[model samples]
Target: MEPESGVNGTAIAEFILLGLVESPGLQPVVFVVFFVAYLVTVGGNLSILAAILVEPKLHTPMYFFLGNLSVLDVGCISVTIPSMLGRLVSHKRTVPYGACLTQLFFFHQLAGVDCFLLTAMAYDRFLAICRPLTYSACMNHTVQRMLVAVSWVCAFTNALTHTVAISTLNFCGPNVINHFYCDLPQLFQLSCSNIQLNELLLFGLGVLMAGAPVILIVTSYTHVAIAVLRIRSAEGRKKAFSTCGSHLTVVGIFYGTDVFSYMRLGSVEASDKDKGIGILNTVISPMLNPLIYSLRNPDVQCALRRVLTRKQAMV
Candidate 1:
């Protein structure tokens, strides 16, 4: 087909988002489900943020990073879920070119932050478990902030790489992305221009951003396991595992879904199966993270109770 949105002046303006759930019969049902899920996700993450901020008992490196993860979770889901929800019911599932790119950029940026921050938390656990005496010095306030700052910087840089690569592509007719959101692979299928180099970039950067973190997290946990095993008492082992257990669970879910979905060859067309998996990474993970990480922790629970009670009294 001739070029419709390309270097030539015939640049097509917007893209049609043919969302994951296509059935008009089921759109209403799916919309309500996803809409409620989105609300719970935002509210859950916000509660975590508030709890972390208000609870001085939780003013530590681990909770600091957990708070960041909660923020990223809220952002990552918000970036795509709203648009996907709109696509479910609206007759016109159109997203402006600029708006779609903006969504894509933030999705990558926040997701990258999520990955890096998890890795950082793993290291914090490693120090706490293996080198308890030096953990405080190694993971001081300055270092904690630095790790988070670096995560944001590195993630932002990675996102910029993807956004620039995607923006340069040409989109001819059939400017429709099949997936719920503007995922890189789905966008690749729409590009009329050569994508060899873009595919190469995705593969290279995907490994750097996703693969590297997995390796680091695994290495850190390996050391953690060894340290935990060395502890003679059962209580000692239990206590050690408790510190990192929630983080490990989150890492598994985040990486399991993301690496599987985005790590596929860019040349491969995004399938319905991929969109189904995307829900796990984007929607379910965010909703579950707060519950998994906070409700199980006594500090967060007490803080939430106190905050709620205060709000009730004020009203």
Candidate 2:
């Protein structure tokens, strides 16, 4: 694309992606590793999702939320991984402006929903352990669907806000994005327009999208810890703790990388660090989430066995 009359350099039509690996020799190796990761993430999440849907006995508020999370992980991985894998192999890795917007929109939307879903899952654990008597009445299917619907609405609005804001930014030149995927922070670095409002918007929504959920998860777990302590039997406490263990691990990996990425400033050196963090968030974290859940969960194990056994018997 050529520069229009009176525009500085060439009017930016597309942005080049500098993927995780810059070395020509390392690209194939890195591509294979992440391609394997993508397959594992998709396969693991689908297994959990299928188990929950197929097994009538495994249907509960916890697995309901788990299924949603699995689906989101699949979506999250899908949006970025395809482009990233392509960039690793291909010389031409320019993503058009419209494509960037679409990627940004879905990524953030899924992220927001992921956060809320984790919060809901945490709350579900809290209810099951703390308020066991009313757990069913409190978190019926209707309420679960409502919480999910609200999460989608809020996340959709947030993503739309950012996408529209990004659309208005002026990029005169230097159209190379530092990361494999089109992230808001990376986009901000290339913008010639003033981005203070954009920064404020991100900060404000970061509190809602991420901050509030962290606070709630902490608070819920605090009560959970106290309740577990009060349990008379060691076995009872172990079972209770086991249920939350996977989610807490998943949350740590997710928010640890997430906070680092968004909280820090972008730079020449930090770009590589951001890419590493992005790999964790996009690749490692998704695959680990379902594994963490299923390994710790006996009900899921039995259900998965049932699913596999049925498939094998049919075959």
**Candidate topping TM-score:** 2
| Candidate 1 Cα misplacement greater than 4 A, ranges | 1-10, 266-268
Question: Pairing residues by index, what is the TM-score of model 1?
Answer: 0.93
TM-score of each: 0.93, 0.94
Error of 2 at 47 (Å): 0.4
What 10-residue stretch in candidate 2 is worst by lDDT? 1-10
Q: For residues 124-148, what per-residue lDDT tens digits would candidate 2 score against the true structure? A: 9999889999999999999999999
lDDT of 1 by residue, 34-110 (tens): 99999999998988889888899989888999899999999989998887876665667898888888888999999
Candidate 1 clashes: the total is 0
Clashing pairs in 1: none
After superposition, the stretches of candidate 2 with alpha carbons farther than 4 Å from their true spots are: 1-10, 266-270
User: How high is the CA lDDT of each candidate model?
Assistant: 0.85, 0.87
